[model samples]
Target: MSLRTRLTLLFTAIVSILLALFCGLLYGVAEQYRLREFHARLQAEATTAGHLLLGQERISLNLYKLMDRNQLTVLPDEELIIYNAQNRLVYESGTDYLALTPETLTRIRNEGKVVWREATREIVGILFTDQQRPYIIVASAVDTYGVRTVASLAQLLGIGWCVMTGLMLIAGRFFAGRMLKPISQINQRIDTITATSLSSRLPEGSQGDELTQLARRFNRMLNRLEEAFKLQRSFVSHASHELRTPLTAITGQLEVSLLAEDEPDELRATLRSVLDDVRGLNRMTNGLLELAKASMDASAVPMGPVQLDALLTQIQAKIQQLQPDYTIHLRIDPPDTHASDWQLTGSEALLRTAFFNLLDNGGKFSPDHTVWMQLIRQGTELQVTIHNTGVPIAPDQLPTIFSPFLRGRNANGHTGHGLGLALTERIIQLHQGQIRVDSSAEAGTTFTVSLPG
Candidate 1:
């Protein structure tokens, strides 16, 4: 069933049950009042019969019988019976509907008064005394008027209960629809949003309710999606242009060499030029692959404790081996702790690649071919700084320095595909660390990295 229907049924069912209980209670009280009132009337009739038949101021037996015959009775189906102390019947209203027993008479004499029922008839018995002699009076009757009143009340209550239940059901359905109208509007608005219309935002009302919060969250997600789309477009455009350059150079050189039959030395020179271009192309391809790998979800990368001091030492040795003329100085400033303090949680290979790129850049951009590296322990963080004497980067280029395929004016004579810094930044971010760079004429160029220790 739909939510609105279910809500309506549940609301109606609860109120209906309470109403039924109230109607039943009212009927019971009315019935009990009718029975008590009728019993009182029967007792009065019994006392009156006793006084007239057995009291000192007695009425003639023949006169009382005449009065009863002339329609002077107090109740319908009324009967009266009187007995003296000798157990002899003295007077009767002339009715055979009620039969008195020895046990019943004894009870009435001992208790002084008693009342009981037999099917639809109510009976009352009382003790009477005149001149120190005892007598018993019994009266029986059916309450015809009271019974009709109670029956009519029951019929009325049943009809009212049914009518109220139906009205409540209708009211419940109308209110439930009003409560769900906001969600219906939200669904319609969501349908209008598509990939091409990421800028289209949901209307967030001033009401500080949960629905308004939901709309704000959706708008924030759309903002992130739009940013990602722009980055992807830029990445593809830059990669295509970079890849085509070296390939075109190699093709042109070979075509020209084949057209003219040059000497062996000239042909060898042309072939070597082509070989150099191919190597540069291969390096650029490898950088692009590494950059893509670093951009993946951080949870997918395997993690373990890596010693930053040891990883940096390895990078320094590897860089020097590749470029023998480059010089690297490494130093660590420990804070009175154990060797384990240098360890942090991350993917070791990725961290090593990140440090290698930073150290290589420091030496490549410096005039003296020298790079200085330092590690310091500060509270719960480990900070590393790499400094090199070089031409300072322009202030306008700081913001986009880590973006893919972006280079600065100081990078004119450098041999790189401009993917190294971007890959390094991504790897550090995957390890939940931060990397920042500062360059100026007074301090040369320096890169700082911070990681959880």
Candidate 2:
């Protein structure tokens, strides 16, 4: 069954069991009340018959007839039998439906009063004493009318149970639908959303129930997916333009040379121009590859612990090999610390690529070809700062410079694809680290990387 049907059925079943018990209890109480009232009427009739038998001067047949017709009349269908102290039948009244036996008489004498049932009839036996003479009065009557009344009540109760159960089932289904209406609306809205229509959202109710929380979480997930799609589209568009420019240059240069039949010197210069375009193309392609790798998992990149001070020394040595005349000053704050505390968990190659990009940017931008590299420990985190005495980046351009192919206005004459800082950010994010940049006229530009030690 559907969830709505199941919920309705469950509620109906619970109410059904409770109503059944209530009906049984009501019937029992009603039956007990009717039986008690019947016994009381019998006792009253016995008292009246005892007075009639003893008040006479002589026990005659007319006296018996007078008592039978007038004295013993009480409730409908009532039968009366009177026995003397010797246990002999003295007078009888009403119908002789029940006969008194010796055993029955003995019990009534001992108990004074007794009540019992025979088939469909109720019997009450009472002992009456007047002037020390004892008499036994046995009375019986069929509660036919009372029985019919109880049966009618039972039939009414059965009908009421069925009617109420059906009503409860209908009410349960209606309320369950009202409660889950939001979920149906959400499902419909979600069905209409596709990759191109991620802007659509589920409607949320004001109530802070589970459904509200679910809508909020789904909206958050949609926001993330939309952002990722936009970023991917931007990267692909920029990459296409960047790749096309170099290929166009190389193709044009080769076409002109082929048409000129080429003087050796002119052909050599055309080849040189084409060679330069090919090298730039190679560099841009390699930068794009590095950017892709930075976004990958640590397992794909082969991770290990990298020591900070040692890594910095190695970068300095490598930069010296490329630019022997360049100089960078290195500093460490409060140097007394454990060696293990300086270690970071990550891919050595990826970390080295990120550091190289920062250093290259620092040197390329610095007027004096000099930069400052600082290593510092703060609690359980290690920080590396590269401060270059370069022209400060414009405040507005600082935000977008880390985006792919987006160079600062100050980078007008720079010879590099703008993928460096963006790649560095992706690598740091992959390792659960943070990178931030501060730039000003007084401070020049500073790039700080913070990683867990």
What shift in Å separates residue 94 of candidate 2 from its native position after superposition? Answer: 13
Q: Write the per-residue lDDT of candidate 1 for residues 104-176, one digit (tens) a residue.
A: 9999999999989899988988898888999998888888888889999999999999999999999999998
Residue 438 of model 2 has an lDDT of 96
lDDT of 2: 0.85
lDDT string, candidate 2, 101-174, tens digits: 89999999999899999898898888888788888988777877788888898899999999988899899999
Clash pairs for candidate 2: none
On a 0 to 1 TM-score scale, where does candidate 2 land against the true structure?
0.73
Q: TM per model?
A: 0.73, 0.73
